[model samples]
Target: MNGSSALTLAGVLVLLTVVAVVIRPRGASTVDFYLAGQRVGVATNAWAICGDYFSAASFLGVAAAVYATGLDGAWYAVGFAAGFVPVLLFVAAPLRRFGEFSIPDFLGRRLGSEKVRLVAVGVVQVVILSYLVPQAVGSGITWELLVGSGLLGLSPYATGILVSTAVVAGLVAFGGMRGTTWTQAVQFLLLLGALVWLAATVVGEGFHYGDAVADLSRAPLENPAPDGGLTSEQNALHPEEPAIFGQPGARYGGLGQFALIVTLALGTAGLPHVMNRYFTSPTGAAARTTTVWVLCLAGIFYSLAVMLGTAAREIVPTAVDDHPWLADLTVDGVLQVPEHALPVLGRIYGGDAGLGVVAAGALIAVMSTIAGLLLAAAASWGHDVYERHINPRATQRQAVLAGRVTTLVTACAAAGLGLALRPETFATATASIVATMVTWAFAIAGSALTPVFLLTIWWRRTTAAAAVAGMATGMLVAVAMFTAGLFAAGGLLREALVTPTLVAAPLAAAVTVLVSLRTTAPADVEKSWLIMHGTAADRHAERLAQLVLDENRRRRAGRRARRARG
Candidate 1:
């Protein structure tokens, strides 16, 4: 890494640490630590939500995917943004209305069963840990490329993972939801700004977006594998073999394409960290509006990302002859590591300053997302498990302390796993290792939590027993299929099993419905539905009633003082 780039990257991290210190939550209440005192506004929360959702995968992998494959690569962004539609339609409002500390907390209370909460907690941890490892790994990869050296007697990769994990985890532990929210909001703006700056530079430097896509589409899409030579099934499926900028069959086959889309779309409705952010909204309506804003922001961010990828494809072949680093990583004029597509573009178009901005955005992407994941981890294991089960009578201070401890422990575990990986895996493919780990978390969350969550909120007949049974069935089946798929040879069966939500989700929903039919409903099932479906006006009324009760207590206290004076 160049001195200018290292200084820029280090400045951003220092600024974030200052932000964390400034906004860190105070007091020992769980409310302050866990949900930011439930006062986050729609715009602020929306940005934070974007920061949480757009991990290293979105910032790097999407563009890389597009750079390598003509039209098929854009699916990553499309499927990811599509997920919020389900969140807005089915989950955002209801989930906020039915809110607790986290997903598991909501489930446990809604079903009137601790067992259901425990099951949800386990599933959520699996999702969080799976997601956290990649963010950590991505941090290491970014550090190696942008900073080029390690500190504290460690390898660059190890230093990257440990430092990022420690800093973000400490932010969460100290500032909790409040500190992370503001930091994430800022991080997201930085990310969007980086994309916009790079886009403007590339376009201004004589790259026409439409012409680039049009020209690339006319030829058969080549695989951007490190070793090369994978056939384009997309071209074979259609005899004309016309170049299209937005067609299927680059990395995934026809069915594989649909499966990936469905999994990603449905998966958003169940992600632990994403939904946990909703709980920090001031009202259910705030959460709903936040989703709308997220859609807009994501649409803008991802469209730019795809365009950048297109620019890289058009610009890199010639630029490689000029930059020695580019030539070393390229195989036959195509980059061996697709993720380098953007950084190379930055150096080619905007020089060292541009490279620094893109590199900082990557680190921000990893750290900001990790903040939300660690917070969610604390909510599940610390608030939901340690406080609820182990110390039911624990004080508020004790509860918050538990959350802090969990944050540190979870961060360490994920960082250690990240240090074990080879950074090359994250840099090369369209379906890079970082992206794949995120997909596994998504697939598992979709199978185990989404069906039961939707049913609990919208279906009146969803019993606690049914929720538990359905969750168990989903998790077991997903794992079994995932294991089998790993062992199977590459083909349609492998593709379907590797990303198995299309099948697993339906099976989970079926099991939930069948079990619900045979079981007795909770005594307050109707009341739960009312809470889940309550309007904004109803929530206003509830808050107004609480205000009246507080006023009444003040008047009574005033009268008691008068009597004492007499």
Candidate 2:
């Protein structure tokens, strides 16, 4: 990009960083560092949740999926948005009420078992690492494409990976959750703004989304089919598919594929980084309200992304000879990189500067997500591991320091993994696989933890043993399925094995109920239930409102007194 463009992007990023760092609450307490002192308002918390949730996967992968697979690509957005519904109904309020630092902390406390906590921590770490690496990789890919900068003979990909990793690590280490939360919330707004602007511009340029879809539907899709060249049979199955859009059924088929979608949608409630955001809110009600906001924002963003992807398919000819970038990268005029479609659209509308903006946005999306992930990892390691396990008597300052160190270490590890994996696949493909892998994490969390959490808050008879057994079984099944799918060849068996949440989640819930029925309930279960589900949160909300009013009244009174004295 040009100097002015680079400066513009840098100026925006620096301004955001300043706001995040300066506005962070002054305190080094563990609660402040990890949960923003649990004082984040509903609207800010909602935006931060959106920032955490809308990773590189959502920003790039959704559009790329549509660009590559036609209408079928829209399923990613559908599944993603649908996942929040279950979360709102089942997980949100209860989790906030549970009041824990991390998922493992919540599980450990709820079940009253240190062993359960340790096991949950291990699983949560694995999930975070699995999810984190690909985001780092995405950051690298975006930088490489946008800046075309190669340092020390390194490719743009390597440069991107290093820069993003360092930046995110620094942000987390210095600002912690207080800074991270505000930064993420602002980042979410920027992402939404960018998408809205791009969408409007594209529409203004006469790119009709509905007409584009109709036109794409009427053409033949020429894609890389499993058995080589697109056969007549494949075309017959996807008659309405356009040449730019891949053939239907070429991706996957039957119940197994549907299971993937279900797993992803249902599994979202369980993600540690995502679930942890709820804890930042002051009360259960605020968490619930935040989720409602997230649902609305996500729905709008994903819908626009889907439309943009469809627009790319309609506007950009499949044949590379027709476009400038395609000739440089494609063989025989066919585009190979699916991820480039969105950037290409930006270039077509806003030229080089627009392309840089979208690319920078992609980078910001990754960085914001990585920052959240790192914080969650820090909480898991610092609070759950070091403080709880190694040094029970450690001071709050000690815990915060440990979290900062862990954030640095985790970011470095993720960067190494990103570099190692950068050449293996395209950014879009890697993002999907990472997202899919985390599906098991979500499933286990939703199935095992969500039920126990809900019942703990609402029902009085949820035994500790039931909670322990449920989380254990859920984790075991998800791990087994994930491992089996990794080794298994591409087929029906693989699809079934790969996306285990569809099968494992239900099984986990069943075991939890059955085990609870067999075991004697904890004596404190009723007390805990009341604490979790009672009106304390409502009372807290009323108190906060009264405090705001009182403050405002005092300010006005002070002004009157000063005037009278003068």
Candidate 3:
């Protein structure tokens, strides 16, 4: 990249840092650090949720998947975005009304069981770590591809991982949730803008997305199927297939795979980082509004991404030897490094400067996501572990310090994992692995915690023992499935065992309900339901809004009075 381009990228990062520092919450209190004092507005919270939800997976991974696999790659986008719809309808509002600092905290209070809280903390930590490692790997990979040189004798991959991780850790440590929220919201908008701009430029080049797709479809798919149909592999590996559709694989399949889609779509409500965002909103109404905005924005972003992927398919010939830069990167012209396709496309259209902007956007996406995950990790550890178990008498400042320390430790661990597991390339492989690891976490949360949470707020017969039993069974089943998948050889057995949530979640819920039926409901169940479902929090949020307005009016009146006196 040119020095001017490098400078532009550096300037953007510095500006973001400064803005975050300026808005950093002004207290060391756990509430302020963890939840931004619960004062974020709906629109801002929505953007931050986007930032948190759309990680390296959404930015580089989804685009790369589309670039490599064609229409098959679009499945990732569909699965990811569709997951949010369930979250908005079934999870968001009540989660916000629960008003807990973290998922574990919410479960602990509602179920009235510290054991359940600990179990939740353990599950959440595992999910966060699983999700964090891939993001670090992505940053390293992008850095190596974007800038040929590594900083300070470090490999470009290592440098990328270190720098990006450190920057995010510092952001979280200094700004806490308040600063992180504003920065994330802005960052997501920039990401969306980058996507929109790229899409417009690609279209302006006289490339019609629909036309391109039709052309691609007319070509023979490369891979041979069980029934002699084409597969993605055939299309990607064999260039002999007509260049229109590029390659052919399963465009659509039986209901079994459809079940996987259903699992993912319903699973979004269970993700830790996503659920954590709901608590940051001031009220249930704000949370609902935020989800609505997220749905619209996410839908737009994913649609454009799918279109861009199609354009790349049409514009960039499959033969790597045909392109100058691509020849150097991929031996066979098929993108071995799936992440490189989007950046390469950026350069092809906008030259070196455009590549720099796109590369920088990828970095920002990783950084924003890492910051959110680290904070979530810190909250789970510090609040759920140190304060709740180790030192019930710990002060708020002490708890905040613990959380910050945990954030640093978690970041380091993720960086180390990324370095050690330097995979040859990241494609759907990385994404699938990350998704699989968290799938169980979501299942457990949805089946066990979510049920208890809902029932506590709606039904009057949810007991503490039942919640504990439900969470334990959910955790056990999720772990068993994960272990079986990891240890078992590839085949139908593995696929069935690997996605345990499809089995475990329902069983967990069943156990919880069955157990609860035999026990007496907690006396506080009705009162808790009133708090969780009633509009007290919404009313409080409205009152807070009025106070802000009134304060602004008084300030204006005081200024006028001063002017008259003068």
Candidate 4:
């Protein structure tokens, strides 16, 4: 590694360590450890959620997709940003109002069924693992590109996976949700700052966005082929046509595009890590406000990402003559690993320092996301499973220990999977495999958990039996369709299978409705409804807080009067 680049990365890691240590949770209370005492502010939680949500996929893969596929790639950003709308309107407030450590905990208590809670735990783990592995893979990719060196006799990619997972796991295990939230918020600022700096640099260099798109569209799109050369790609939407960079069919057909959007848009509500952030809000209203802030922030971040991707596509080719090192990373002006688009652009503009900034941002993206996922996993396994089921009378200290252990184990598993599914294995298949991998998680979440989760909150008649049925059906259907998609040749069928949320979510909801009609609702359905939708608890909490503040003020005034008399 270059000394400057190494120093930049080490500096970022050290800063995160300091933050985690400084604000680390002190109590043995699981509430403090897992949910940060449910006192996080709207804007801070919004930033932390963005940090958790905008993983390597958002940081690296979105730009990679845009760089490789052009217009279709932009849809990823649009879909991701739009996904929060449903959450804001339907899920956010009620979810926070319900107030639980995890999705499984909420479902179990809401439905009054241990079976529902246990089953939900299984599904949550699946979603978390699905999300976690891609983050690990992203870390590996970033390390390979940024450092270009191995550690402990491993490949740079594998070393990246292990090191990142280990560090983030340690942070979550010790720091808990409070520390993770603070660090995530900071990490997101770094990510946004890096993007802004890169965008400004590119724009300053006399690059016009419209002219670049028009120029790129004038020629056929080509990418690095697996066989070490460039190849012209045909449009998947219209098989007879050559793909154009500015058009819609570079990577996905019309149906594929719609499927991708639907999957991501619906999936946001069901992501355990993201959903868990809602629980950290002090009130349901704060949760809703956080969603609004998240939407606005996401729009800005993604718009810049799309622009930077375009800049990379337009600028990288011209720089190859002057920067010979880039030639090895690219083939005939196109990146072999599409995820390298941003970092490569950074190098071209600011040399090693620019690349360091961008690379550090990528790693930050991976680690922050990993921290969220690990915490989610801990909540599910430790609080939901171990505390509730395995050891019902477990002490607060025991529960916290359980969570830490779960975090470490889950992180290790994700790292191992990342190494197995290394990027080079399918280097030429898609421009940004990380984004596609994340979409699979979206499909699973949208199909399984989201359908049942929404029905539980809105439909008073939604029974525990129906929830189990809906969740089981959604998970199985999504997994089966994705498995079939792996072998199918390209077309609408493949698109539907791979991005199965459009089919699976509706089917899951339908099953839930049908099953609920035949089953008895929970006996406390009305009570649960009041808890979920009523504002009484929020009002009470506000009054209690005001009383405490007034009391403190009176005590201060009395002390001042006594001092004046003396």
lDDT of 4 by residue, 1-566 (tens): 44466547646754764475466555579998999999999988999999999999999989999998999899899889999999999999999988999999999999999999999999999999999998999988888888888898999999899988998999899889998998899889888988999999999999889999999999999887777788888898889999999999887888889999999999999999999999999988899999999999999999999999999999989999998998788888778888999988888888888888898889989999999999999999999999988999999999999999999999988988888997877676666889989988999999999999999999999999999999999999999999899788878888888889989999999999999999999998876787788788665775687799999999999999999999
Please, what are the lDDT tens digits per residue for candidate 3 over residues 59-89? 7777765665566567768877888787777
Error of 3 at 105 (Å): 0.9
Clash count, predicted structure 2: 5
Question: Evaluated with lDDT, which candidate comes out highest?
Answer: 4
Q: What digit string (tens of lDDT, one per residue) describes model 1 on residues 142-196?
A: 7777777899889888888988889888888988888888889988888888888
**Whole-model lDDT values for every prediction:** 0.82, 0.74, 0.72, 0.90
Steric clash pairs (candidate 4) = none
Show where candidate 4 strays beyond 4 Å. 1-3, 6-10, 537-566
State the lDDT at 559 in candidate 3. Answer: 100
Please list the residue runs of candidate 2 whose C-alpha ends up more than 4 Å from where it truly belongs after superposition. 1-11, 224-250, 318-323, 331-334, 423-460, 487-491, 536-566
User: Estimated TM-score per prediction?
Assistant: 0.91, 0.86, 0.84, 0.94
Q: What lDDT would candidate 1 get against the real structure? A: 0.82
lDDT of 4 at 275: 96
> On residues 222-302, what C-alpha lDDT tens digit does candidate 2 reach at each position?
443333333221322333542335434534445554776787677677678898989989988899999999999989989
